[model samples]
Target: MNIVVILAPFSLALALIGLAAFWWTLRNDQYEDPQGDASRILIEDPEDRPL
Candidate 1:
């Protein structure tokens, strides 16, 4: 019973923080280029090759 009093606000604060971060990403266009990013990781660049 007492634990709920302490945990409820803490949980709500964490949820709000997560939501804010998600909103920030949306405003910053961070979600763009999902497929491009996925395909990009598969390519091997010459600079990454062993010396």
Candidate 2:
């Protein structure tokens, strides 16, 4: 009863904060190179080895 009244607004605020952060990331192109990073791991850089 009383606990729900207090907890509901708190939970909703947290959810809104999370949504804002996700929206900010989208506007910043944070996920643009998702596949690039994954595929890059499989690539070997020749310069990394010493002759």
Candidate 3:
């Protein structure tokens, strides 16, 4: 019963931190090229190969 008091606020704070991080990513356009990276691997570029 005493643990709940400590855990509840801790859990809420953790969730808020996670939400803040997600919001930061959205504002920074971190998700803009989601598909680009996935499809880019299918192409072969000379720059990516070792000389």
Which is the leading candidate under TM-score? 1
The all-Cα superposition gives candidate 3 an RMSD in Å to the true structure of 2.3
Q: lDDT for each of the candidates?
A: 0.96, 0.94, 0.95
Model 1 error, position 33 (Å): 0.7
CA displacement after TM-score superposition, residue 4 of candidate 3 (Å) = 0.3
Check candidate 3 and list the clashing pairs: none
- Give the C-alpha miss distance for residue 40 in model 3, angstroms: 1.4
Residue-level lDDT of model 1, residues 1-51, one tens digit each, is 999999999999999999999999999999899999999888899886779
Tens-digit lDDT string for candidate 2 (1-51): 999999999999999999999999999999999899899878889986569
Error of 1 at 24 (Å): 0.7
Clashes of each: 0, 0, 0
Q: Report the lDDT of model 3 for residue 22.
A: 100
lDDT of 3 by residue, 10-49 (tens): 9999999999999999999999997998998888988988
**True-structure lDDT of candidate 1:** 0.96
